[model samples]
Target: MKDAKNVTITDSEWMVMRAIWTIGHATSRELIDAMNELEGWSASTTKTLLHRLIQKQAVAQHGGSRPFTYKPVVGEKESMAAAADDLFDHMCAMRAGSTIAGVIQSRELSRADIANLQAILAEKAKTAPEEVQCNCLPGDQTC
Candidate 1:
């Protein structure tokens, strides 16, 4: 399966995406106006951002008015997960062990989050055989 669509946002595009995500839905004019205050952007800039978002399948458009209304096409969870995966992939590709260690060390988890992650790890460990396994190959190990 493909990764989630939302993390596809570029740094610049994220500003636009946040606006759309926050509004849920807004007219292009409204968006442009909103961005002008935060970014001092021109209408054309907002329009370009909209086009980029549409191309990425991150934003949805509707209405036949002069300016269409746009909304976020990706759900919040999908967006967050994709963002996390993207960051993880970058870190892994760079230096896997250090990246993982840094994440564990740096993250500020709530009690619930810590408990949940611990429970999940325990469950996986219990269900899994002793060795770490790859299920992709024909001679796959215990996965």
Candidate 2:
């Protein structure tokens, strides 16, 4: 299995990955049907996406029969974290806190999730810098 941080999954591919992760393992027909139902994708379109995933080594094909099983080669949680990190890396560092706050405000988090976040923030508060510098360009340009 390839590490999630090393693989770059596109948005469409992420949709397919979500389905595969939710299903655990499935055949092409199963994926085709799921994609069709969820995204109104054609069988060929799903097949193409599957082929691309296979090429990227993010998914694997198994069994010797006509209807082979496909499983994720990358983990869902790890992939999501990596994607989030990638997104944050492109944004101004100073805005990350407020951006994260916006996401937390918009998303429905469980009690445990909120607790974990609070713990993490409490720990970070000890050594966190007073100000975060913007890194949008060379030197000290702000976004």
Candidate 3:
């Protein structure tokens, strides 16, 4: 299994990964149908994407016979976290809190999710700095 942090998934590939992650394990036909229905992708397009994922070692093929089963070699949660981290890494560090706030406001989070976030925030607040430094520039300039 490939480590999610080490793998870089494209947006289109993330869609395929979502399907595979949801299904747990699936056949090529199953993936093709799902992609067609969800994204209106052609069978060849799905196949090509699958091939690329396999080469990346983010997915693995199983069974000896035809219609082999495919499963994710990378974990869904880990992949999502890695992707989020990658996005934040590119942005100014000072904007991360506001960006996170925007994301939290935009999404429909469950009560449990909210509570978990609250707990995390409470813990973090104890040691939280008064200000976040901007990393977008070489010196003290802010973005």
Candidate 4:
């Protein structure tokens, strides 16, 4: 499996990954059927996406039969975290707290969700460094 930071799953690829993740593992024909049923995509389209995913090391291919079964190389949580980090990294790090607060306030979180978020935040706060280093890109002004 490639490092999480190196994996880039496009929106279309995510759909295929989601199906494979939900099923735990699936063959090409099974994946094509599932994707077709869900999004009306052709077999070739699904195959192309699967091939790209495999090339990117986002999906693991298992052998031992005529048709191989595929599974997500990266778990959902890891993928989500990497995607989220990418989004935040493009924004101003200095305003990250405000940005996160705004997003939280925008969402209608359930009680359990709120509790879980609170616990996660508390744990993260405890381990957070006193000073964060800025490694923004040269052309970027939102450091």
> Candidates 3 and 4: which is better by lDDT?
3
Q: What lDDT score is found at residue 9 in candidate 1?
A: 79
In order, the Cα lDDT scores of the candidates are 0.75, 0.94, 0.94, 0.88
Number of residue pairs clashing in candidate 4, backbone atoms closer than 3 angstroms, sequence gap of 3 or more or interchain:
0
**Tens-place lDDT digits, model 1, residues 1-143:** 22355338777788888888788889988988998999999999989988988888788789877668888877767877788776765532334445666787898989998899789878977776544333343563332
Query: What's the distance in Å from true for residue 34, model 2?
Result: 1.0
Candidate that beats the other on TM-score, 3 or 4, i.e. the better one: 3
**Model 2: how far is 94 from its true place, Å?**
0.8
Candidate 4 has an lDDT of 0.88
Report the lDDT tens digits of candidate 4 across residue range 1-143. Answer: 55677899999999999998899999999999999999999999999999999999999889988699998898887888899899998876666887889989999999999999999999999989876555565654445
The better-scoring model by TM-score among 2 and 4 is 2
Tens-digit lDDT track for model 2 on 1-117? 689998899989998999999999999999999999999999999999999999999999999998999999999999999999999999989899999999999999999999999
In model 4, what are the clashing residue pairs, if there are any?
none
Query: Any idea how many clashes model 3 has?
Result: 0
Model 3 — TM-score against the truth?
0.95
The order of the candidates by TM-score, greatest first, is 3, 2, 4, 1
